[model samples]
Target: MYDRKDPYYKKAKQEGYKSRAAYKLKEIDKKYNLYHQNSRVLDAGCAPGGWSQVLLERVKNGVVVGVDILEMDSLNHPAFHFIHGDITEDETVERILEISDKYDLVVSDAAPNTSGQKLLDHVNSVELVQKIAELTRKVLKKKGTFLFKLFEGEDKDMVLKGLRKDFDMVKVVKPDATRKNSFEIYVICRGYKGEQG
Candidate 1:
C-alpha cells in the first residue's frame, strides 16, 4: 500500500525540500561517496530542482548546471545554473558545453509520462535513458560519474552491459526512500573511461 503522503514525501515537506526524490540522491551519495566539495555536475531533466539542490550543497565550489525542457523554479545559489531546454537536443548540449568544458558528474531523474502499461513504460524508460547516456558521453569528463533513474525491465541488463564498457564500475540501486511498489531504480556509472562514442 503506497500512500500519497508516504514517509519520504512527508519528510521532504517538513524539511523544506522540493520533492521526495531528494532523499534518493542523498542516500545514494552517502553509500557511494560520489561527490566532493568541488565537483562540477550536469543535472539533466532537473525540473523542480531537488537533485540540483543537493548537488549545490554537496559541491560547495564547483558549478551545478541543470537542463530540462520544462521550466524550473529558480534556485538562487551562486554556483547553481539552469538551462530551459531539452537535454537531448544539440542546441541544449551546445549551451551546456559552453557552460563548462567537461563535467565531473551527470545526473538525471527524467522519465516519460507513463500510460499505466508496465512493459511499454519500461521500454520508453530504456530509450530515454539511452538517449541521456549519449548526452552524458558528450559532456562528462573521462573519469567522471553518471547517475540516472531507470524503470526496471528485461532489457536493463543490455543497458548495464553497454555501460560497463564506458565505466569501470556500474551498479544499480534502489534507495530506501523509493516506494516499494515503484519499479524505478537508479544506475550509478563511475570512473568513466570514455569507452563509447
Candidate 2:
C-alpha cells in the first residue's frame, strides 16, 4: 500500500513547494542525471511551477521557461520564466522560440482533461505524449533530453517504437514517488537524432 504520509508530501508542505510532483522530477533527475548547473530547460504544462522550482535549484545559471494553459501567479525567481498559452498552438511555439535559446532539456507533465472513460483516457494520454514528442524534436537542441508523462496502454509499443527512431535511448520509468495505483509513467528519452525537414 502507498503511504499517504510520504516524506515528499511532508517536505513539500514544509518547504512551500507548490505540489508533490516536485519530488517526482527530483527523483527522475537524480536517477537519470538529467539536470545540470548550466542547463536551459523548457517546461510544458508547468502551472504552479513545482518542477520549475526543482530546475531552478539544480541549474546554477540555468533559465527555465514554463508554459501552461492556466494562468500562474507571478514568480520572482531570477532563473524562472512563465508563459501562459497552449503549447500545441503554433503561435505559442513561436513565442517559446522567441524567449528560448538552445534547450538542454524539455519536460512535460501535460494531461488531457479526463472524461472518466478508461479507453478514452488512455487514448488521450497517448496523443498528448506524441504531441510532446513532436514538439521536442522541433525545439530541443541536439542530444537534448525529453521527459514526459504517459499512461500504459495498447499504444505504448507504438509510442516507444516512434521514440526509438528519433532518440538514441528511450526508457519508461515508474518513479518511486508515483502512486502504484496510478497509470501514469514517465518516458525519458536522451539524445535527439534531429528531425527531418
**Each prediction's Cα lDDT score?**
0.90, 0.86
Q: What digit string (tens of lDDT, one per residue) describes model 1 on residues 1-197? A: 33566988888888878878899999999999878989999998888888888888878889999988888789999999999987778899899999898999999999888888999999999999999999999999999999999999999999999899999999999999888888999999999996454
Q: Candidate 2 lDDT (Cα, whole model)?
A: 0.86
Model 1 is weakest, by summed lDDT over 10 consecutive residues, at 1-10
**Regions more than 4 Å wrong, model 1:** 1-4, 195-197
Clashing pairs in 2: none
**For residues 1-197, could you state the per-residue lDDT of candidate 2 as single tens digits?**
32558787778889888778888999999989997888889999998888888888877787899999999886678888788998888888888788774688999988888777778898999988887787788899988899999877889989999999888999999998887677888999999887767
Winner by lDDT: 1
RMSD in Å for model 2: 2.2
